[model samples]
Target: MSYQDIRSTFKLISGGLSETIDDSPKEFVSASITDTRLMGVVSMCVHWRLPENSHLTDLHQFFYFDAEESGFETYRSVLGNGGPSEVQEINDIEDYLMGGLGGKRVILTEREVRYMLQSYVDLNLRSGLSLPEDKDEYEFMLSPRVRLTDSEEYVLMCKQCPGLDSPYQVINYFLMRCVGKDFGAAKFLTKGYVRTNLFPNHKGATLLRNVIEDSPDAVSGSNTDYHVTDDDKDFGTFNTFKSYMCESLIEYSGKFFLLITQITLDHLKIVKYEKISEFQVSAAEASMMTSRPEFITVTDLVPSAPEFDRHTTKLTSKSMVTDYENGQLFMIFQPHNDHVKNATYLLNDDVLGVYYLLEDNQLILASYNLSDIRRMELDLAESSMAPYIVPVSKYEFKDPVLFDFINSSFDDFEDFVATITKPPAE
Candidate 1:
């Protein structure tokens, strides 16, 4: 039968069959189960007759009836004949409706029915399926079990039921309608696309908002306007180069060295001012030097001295000398005619300490010690002559490994010279 017809039939039978024993409140209290599977069980109670002048009795009896089952006969047997009650399978809705009805039957008005249903809803929210000790556990029990299969249905229900504002009520309704055994609403709620509008403005909704906002898909965007271009890549590369240049200065003691082929007059002035103040060549002199033959012999530039060693026996005119003293001066000599080549030799043959060469406005400064060349490079760079400072070697070593070993082990130029020039260990 239809739900309204069943409710109306239950109301008529309950009112007509109720036994009125005393004038002590003829009010009939009734609760109904709306579950279709349970066939709607009704619990009705009414006050029983008491002896005159006898104290009000505490004992009260309530009749359990279901019209969808065996009808009035079964109810009468249970209530009137006092026979063995039939075992009836009860669900959550039936258990909730039948509880705390006392033992009196009464007809409930529409307002009373609504109030009782609201109370049942409230009680279910407060205590969940059972009275759990933890409030969070109770909330979990009331929360909807939304499975992947039923998620669409639950979402539709949420959209349709605009009046269901309470999160607990919405969850409970969805859970009651769901057929799946496994549920994962919490995991689903963490996804970015899930709609949270149906949820009440509570802590769970707030947390869901945070989760959505923090999601990778939510935080990232696909805007074509923000995409990187070749210009941006170039700019990034430029910035990286600038950073490397700046850091290299720190690595090399606040100085940058470069091997450059060309040098301007202005660059020459910076080199002269910062490094070599004794550079007496004028612009006219530099121009004159570049115009001469590219190949010039060492004898033409500087006079050679007699080779000698202070530690060993004095060298005679015919003796051949392979090595020299530590402080001995030498001339800057280039083996080949090419000025572009940076490899220059410091003649082991004794010679004056100072010599200068100029080609195409490029100046080469040479001295007996390596420290002077390093100092000149530093001063030139400090004066913004970084592009003009050449990385040419001042002298070629007989043993390149020994030279490198000394350079690596010693920071002081004097120590390097002393260590390299010391007598061989016995």
Candidate 2:
């Protein structure tokens, strides 16, 4: 094929790469090359920058024409880039393209480079070459199953969970899941924060400064409330083959919270503290939750409280509730008004709304109709009455004590370590 025709084919492949890959590199370049050893055998070279830790920005991949196979084959497939031979081939191609004028090779634009990098990955995948470990980590980061751990009660409700290989995964499965995206739960209810190595250059700790009694010191990376050190012998573990993931329920400042951590002998990879609302009968409930060791579906977490279940059923079923202009009218028949039985209800004088608890212990505030309130005040007790409810807000009361217990703490950090961990025998 002519150089234009070959370039056209590569352009099409790169375009397809652009549409598919989400975390494609922003800086990269591609150039055409020819091998003097193999006549008419052309190759495409892709180069990209690396992270600061890599110590080198110049890294490359070479896709070459295979005369025997009559197709382009991946020449440099592993982590290391192609060496001198590939560089000479590129120089030869540049000389030919420049008509022996000896000019610099053309660098692909930022947009083109992104596609080129993805194209390099796609070709490597098709050729059955080993991908970089970081690429695999990135794939895990983008997975839907991994991201699902960012929901409240996800890890707590989970009967079976895959072993977390990194601190990021640990954070998602515990802290992020408990508090969600906003720092709302941590700000108003909890008294702790999460520390992780997920963002190395950025701040290591996140959320819950207001409730924590002590301010973060300079030694512990002042961005957080407090920090733990590697020298602390209590965290030392002999097992190094597999990572350690520990969870605990704690009571501090007279409030309850869950502590989940992934650590090693030298590094405390991740630590999260999330507040919980209830503690009674949590031991019995926690035992039942962990009884099954298999993965569970969303249906398993459906609210089980009797009154809440009945109310949800009615709301979902169109016949039991009527949708008015501004709100829903819940029908209550005098003879049998058991749908909302045994459920906690509270009235808010400030907003003139009612707050009710669901089977799952989620508190929901609903606005009442002024006309309905007036009718009740006038002593009009009809056979059937409708209480207009406009769903305003809701909050979940995840009981920390119900968590599958790995450990617990109420003592200060120093005392906790000393009590839990004993010094090695002399």
Q: For model 1, name the residue pairs that clash.
A: 28-106, 28-107, 29-106, 45-104, 45-105, 46-104, 46-105, 61-103
User: What lDDT does each candidate get?
Assistant: 0.24, 0.29
Cα-lDDT of candidate 1: 0.24
Q: For model 1, what is the error of residue 82's alpha carbon versus the real structure, in angstroms, after optimal superposition?
A: 13
RMSD after Cα superposition, model 2: 27.2
Model 2 lDDT-worst window of ten: 341-350
Q: Deviation in angstroms for 207 in model 2?
A: 69
lDDT of 2: 0.29
Summed backbone clashes in each candidate are 8, 0
lDDT per residue as tens, model 1, 331-401: 22212212111122111211112222221222233323355445433433454333434444344333322
The digit string of per-residue lDDT tens for model 2 on 207-248 reads 110111111221222333334446343656322212333343
Tell me the TM-score of each prediction against the true structure. 0.14, 0.17
